[model samples]
Target: MGAAEWMQARSPEQSLTARIVRWYSFLSATLVGG
Candidate 1:
């Protein structure tokens, strides 16, 4: 399954954790790539 489908299968706690990690990754990329 694709990412959206995969994420939908996760529990709410897992979803929240994934969201936090996604934000962290975005920030890190911006900081390092800027």
Candidate 2:
């Protein structure tokens, strides 16, 4: 399956982890960009 399909198949914990990672990356990028 493709990355999008794989992401859709992920479990709840994996989704939560993904959200945390996204937030962490966003925050890190904002800090560094500023």
Candidate 3:
């Protein structure tokens, strides 16, 4: 399956870790950017 399909296949609970990692990266980027 493609990325979109894979993402759609994932449940929110299963994707929580991914979401946290993404959020962490986003926060770190903002801090570093600023």
Candidate 4:
């Protein structure tokens, strides 16, 4: 999905854990690429 669409799709009620998981995965991918 487009960045804007994804940002808009994120609900305020979404759990913090979900965001943490996404952040972890993103960080892992960046580390692996580097």
Which candidate has the top score in TM-score?
A: 4
Each prediction's Cα lDDT score?
0.73, 0.70, 0.67, 0.66
RMSD of each: 3.9, 5.0, 5.3, 3.8
Model 2: per-residue Cα lDDT over 1-34, one tens digit each: 3644455477555776786776688889999999
Candidate 3 residue-wise lDDT, 1-34, digit = tens: 4643454467556576676676688889999999
Model 1 agreement with the true structure over 1-34: per-residue lDDT tens digits: 4764466477456786786787689889999999
Cα displacement (Å) at residue 20, model 3? 0.4
Candidate 1 accuracy as TM-score: 0.53
**Considering every candidate listed, which one attains the maximal lDDT?**
1
Error of 2 at 2 (Å): 27
Candidate 3: segments with Cα more than 4 A from true spot: 1-14
For candidate 4, write residues 3-33 as lDDT tens digits.
4346336944654656667768888999999
| Segments in model 2 whose C-alpha atoms lie over 4 Å from true places | 1-13
Rate residue 8 of model 1 by lDDT. Answer: 48
Model 2 quality (TM-score): 0.54
Backbone clashes, each candidate: 0, 0, 0, 0
Clash pairs, candidate 1, are none
